[model samples]
Target: MTQKVDTAVVLAAGKGKRLDVFETPKPLLKIGGKSLIVHTLDNLKKAGIKNVFIVIRKGDFVQKRELIDYPLNIEFIEQTSGRRGMLDSMLSLEGKIDKPFYVTVSDLILSHNPYKMFVDCGVAGSADTGALVCFDSRQNKESGANTKVLARDGVIREISSRLPSYNALDLGIYYFSPKAHKSICALAKKDKTISSVPQFFVVYSQKEKIRSVEYSGDAWFDVNIPKTFIRAELYLGEENSAESGESKKERTSLKNLPKTVLLHNKKETVTDITVKRNILERLDEYEVIPSESYNSPHHIIVDESIDSFLGKPILDKLLSLGYKVYKHTVKAGENAKSINSYVKLSEEILNKGIDKKSTIISIGGGSVKDMGGFLASTLYRGIGFISIPTTILSQADAAIALKQGVNGGDGKNLIGSWYAPLKIIVDPATILKLDERWVSDGLAECIKQGFAYDKKLYNLLKGYKGDMKDLDFLESVLKLAIEDKVRTIEEDLHEDKIALVNQYGHEFGHAVEHLSGYAYGHGESVAIGMRVSAELSYILGICDRGVVDAHIELLEKYNLPHQVPKVISPEDILNSLKYNKKYYSGEPRFVLVDKIGSVWRDKTYYTVNCRDEFIKQAVEASYN
Candidate 1:
């Protein structure tokens, strides 16, 4: 059984030096359309937190007035020693919270429900003594925050604000039993110079019982700098704007559907002749095909034409390495995703005497990779395949996953396979040659990665100073992007659970792509989808507007589209959503941003059941 917390103490007295807004209290920073304090308050309320004690500076009367009109039940306590810093502010609230309580920073943005964390801590501490929220070490280092904890057999042995080498950082939020609270209070008095919560925790560990509750998902952010400030705003904005009704409908409609594969490829780079050569290379070991005779033979099927340049050179190098090369050229566009194309290519391969022993290499974006992988899977049972993804979309989400398919003319991927690629090679050098529009398209995918799995990636893009076309910068970005995909896929190759996090933008993206008739590239559609997902998550009370806003600002920074085009109707988008691959049993499962690097899939709604009114609102918000 979990212990319920009745009071929450929000530490708001710190004078944020890095934010440079000393004139205004740090908690008052505008995030999305609301103040930071409002976002924090909303999260507490959602978690069933009723009473909140906010510690403020004694002279910050103006800040107090600003928050007086808020809708929640809150008590403001002015700390006489506020200038002494965070530790003193917390100590000031010693006896104000009589019941079990939560302590958190007012400036931190929470993606997960903080109250839930508090409750989990209480439950865990029921047997132990105290529980503190601990986040991943990678996340802490990226944010330049500090945390220290040591545990044994689910019981914290020694918790420190300063450890030799710590893997988890204290999240500045904690659940305290009366006994633990008293111990902390005593530590505060003993260490008068201690300035942070972690330091006090270090002291209490020696005199009282304590344990660390590890938080696995995206839940916390310290918006202490200008960059993080903007990030918080963008995250909140997107959360507040996603389509809720449509997402529910899609989820409900997909409940009874069978899991199937869909394949799509570019027609511009593949032709009947190239297909003929591929078949011949497989069937006749002695026959050799001339690569030069095939038009666009070496042009990889990526989203941008620039990929062809990067791929052609790489193919030449592979050939130089003594590997036999086969070339295929298909016309560019979603129209290439037909049964006719699949059958025609299959017949050509069969005629050429190709068999299961042959290896297939895909060089393109998600479409080409899907088609190529599918063809490889169906030909002669199954064959080895490799993917050389040239677009950011494929590199991050679709590159290494063990799924591929082609969309039928009915606006859905109708045929495919669960074939994993042997390897996926991504070279951002190719992105430098892309047109600005395509670059923006790629940025959408990169941003989606940030939203679903890597806060460092998110912050890197937020602070990016060079041109998007800088090969060096793009290479570095691509490397980081690829690492995120690799990490996720390596942990969950079949997308059983961990990989679901990778779907952060695709739930909404596929619908937008279907409605747009592939006019927009996959990356562009994904950008819009991410924004919609964020908005829906906020409306459903899963996240705050600040998180949504952070997503929007990042999308806007890259000039990615956020709104669906008027040419596509809400009903059309909804209808197209019926084909979402995540649809389970009649419910279209939506992957929403719970916070930066975290995604949630809720199955309560029907697949393809998005309400018309909500879809309209989402489309309208996108334009705004």
Candidate 2:
């Protein structure tokens, strides 16, 4: 049972010293075509928060009131402390919030489900004392704004305003239950003047409970600087474009895909499964097929069981069309994702007298596609390959992205490439045989895509209630995921600029998977990576804590790991990052969120050149 929260307190009273808005409150600065304070208010309303408390400076009350005219009940309080801090504004709200309440900074633009996050924390008692939203610190350019938390078994032990090193940076957003409110008030009385929320939490944690809730799938922006404001605008434009049903054109110059036919035998299957078969058949008829003289020879790759069901008929059709077909299959599991398997497959292709013009068809999950795609890309200096994804995870997420090599002796996908396939043929009808765990794995990637690219996709997942194993729902998810990936790839065909956003989770993921020795699946490692990246983003001041919490929520909802595995120490993980391909000139560059649907790329906003100690602290904070 989750506790319900109805009230929201937005702390907006800070002097705009950093923003150079000495004439006006910082919250009044424009972001994404709206005032920053109004953006916060609108987000709170969107999260279903009814009552709002806006703490403002004494003189700016008139201007603040003029900025927003809403029907929902709103209270305006003035901070009497001259040139005081966040703690002072929060102290002013003392005793006023009688019910469970959420507190956040006014200068942040967040696309998060705050109501759900608060209610979930309330019900789980995840924050017995109080819950602070923690964001990844690596993505931010600004430091020292994050509050570091240390916890064990869901119970927070210590929260430090001046953490020597930490992972989770406290985003100003908080959920305070009645008990927490009492504790905060008591602390305020004892301290007399409140200066920082992190400091308040540190004092409050000594006496009562203080917990942290990680948020996933939300985009948060702190518009304190000019570049961040620009980023916020760009993000808003992207969001608007997505909402308006704008479709980006796909990239060309790759070899054309071959003609494909869907031959399904009479078997017990759902109507949606049949519909999917019809869709594939229709696509074959409508889309243009490549000329064999110019294109590579098409090979028929299928799972052994699927081959038994539909392979013979398809192979016969291709033969009738004067095309030579080669069949390939591999035993399933992580073992299939090996260079050895790829070598054997390559040898088999050569044995068949296949040349550079021969195409390799990959019909399986991510592992099979990854191995086969790598083989085709590297052999004979690159050949054409098509994906026929059978599993939900592959069809929806993994198949759409570029394929890399399999995990080698050191870790998972330790060796790989950025080779895009000629085409990806998604036959969602095959999702019927997927296990629940596989479906969950697929959702993990889907959730990640939603976090990095589309808020509507995130909302769809948030509202989803059917079992993940349901073929129909999984199929729909696959379509959305594919579209998302295609949009990203089209914008960044060579992954030069925009495509870096797609690597959101891979940075931390690679390190974790390497240290785990490939015990965890790609999706699992990515889930943890997403959380760590979000925390790092907050620490670097690229995004707000609320956005970090939103990212955590998506991961948690899908049963993904929010913390790094205990076996891998922070130092080891930090060491592995140095070798990441994204590292530039001795600095580990990060693709961090500027807002939802928008990412800060290398040489765009700010550079990340922190020392090893800072990196260690960030990794440790993510684990806690």
Candidate 3:
């Protein structure tokens, strides 16, 4: 008897778009004398698997009706994630399975039993990888429809159907732990483009690990691939020219760097702003200065709001130092994030002879960072970008973030880049002139972040007695908030669903900001949205009345609005949600917190869908 796993999952939820000629679902297609999924079941039986969960779509009754009498303990899971293919089928098993189990696609037909060795060779006690699978390929011809891989020392470096160069073929079989499932689920939530297993592994290999088991046997082939279909239908595995690919040069993952570069003085302190830091000193320290830039004028992208206090003086100082400088003052508010503003600024900068080798220093707060960083990442393919955050919210948020973009007509920042600046300069003197509202605006973001990940940060904010004028207090908040944010991002370098926790009030908040006709401040809308989220959480019975009260208490402390403006209708906010950038499958997903210190995360879903009735009630309740 083969080794047995008590549980196994069979994925059969694909549309089989290429096999449209056959009226039956691909899993029901007969190979030899049996259906495709039955062949998988027979193999599992031989491997001693007792329980099987087959994932199929909502109306896939034929699969259930056909397998009703199977001896194995079979339960069909209906995939309700809008028919997104194999990826969604896996996600449909969320909270349904908790242990490491065997997995295979229904169309993966095998004549000879490889399951004994597969279950026996399970990966354990390895911190580098939590999942194990096999690889083999007949690399004689251009059979590229199947998943390809490039692995070294039994570790998968790259695996994708779109891989231009690869050495092995994915066996379409896996031993997946709960950790592996979470990685796949998170990538699906954040990025919808990953439909196939290989595409996900390509991204998964970026920060996590995957171990490749050698499978040189001639027993298996996928039915979806046309070339393999003929072999599976006619000869089965009798004539599979299975060959282990030639070993390529061993290359390790040593080139990968941290997505964000947080440079600060190494010494511990209550406030680092008192510690000396400068823009020029950082430029030399990071060596972003190009050889051709000695005579070339470096660009300074400044917002009109700070052009007098900070922008013009910085430009004058550069001129006094005999350094070439080019100052471009963009519109200061939300309008600056408009596509018109971005196009106009780009045209002006290009006309001013900004080249690939030039360094562009971005100054001012949030909108300025959005515009300047987007331009820098796209200009001349890419150029040197230095960030100077001038507000407390942005200081804690940090310009070292990977996402950058300007606004679109339909939504806020619909067009954006998953790119970051080369360096960041933080000088406290820039924030000294900030108005009280600007200070409040900055504090709102830090407060949101604190509630999501760090209770210490929330405690810090709750106990504050002084006004926003306290520089040391501001520095302490920034340090704590930035540290927590960076730690969360480091675990998920792709910033997939894991980082979405920090966006506690963004769903309803973004919609409110858009529908408010630009009259409501970004911070004001977010404050109101936080209240809405808390209300929604209370309605859902996820949190008690105390959590909601504490949420409102903090917002009111900084002169922030906790009640929605009567001018904005709840219906408008509901309709505007689909236009928001984070809309999941056209449904309004809210990130709700059960309490002060943690966000309500359902497995990989940091933001979850809510009924229109509940969302409307929350928004209406917050209205004055």
Model 2: lDDT to the true structure? 0.67
Candidate-wise lDDT, in order: 0.64, 0.67, 0.72
lDDT string for model 3 (147-246, tens) is 6778888788888767798777776777666778877888888898777777787787887778776664555656763334434544442232231212
Candidate 3's displacement at residue 141, Å, is 51
Candidate 2 lDDT, 1-624, residue by residue in tens: 355456888887776566552235678765555677777777678767789888777877564566557756788888888444766666688778777777888776556654466555553333554554555555444423556666565566677766675666566777777677777666776876655667777777777766667655356566666445545655665576565553332324555778598677643311011125434434434221245523345565555665654455555655555666777777676667777877777787777756667777677778877887887778787777766677766776667777457767655666888777766777676666666666676777788777777777778888888676666676677778778777777666656566666677777887887788767777788778877777776665567888788877777777777789777988788778876766654556566665666565544432333335545655777876
Tens digit of per-residue lDDT, candidate 1, span 42-70: 87887877788888877778767987877
Worst 10 residues of 2 by lDDT: 266-275
Q: What's the C-alpha lDDT at position 149 in model 3? A: 75
Candidate 1, after superposition: displacement of residue 170 in Å?
A: 30
What's the TM for model 2? 0.53
* N/CA/C clash count, model 2: 37
In model 2, which runs have C-alpha deviations exceeding 4 angstroms? 1-322, 402-404, 411-420, 601-609
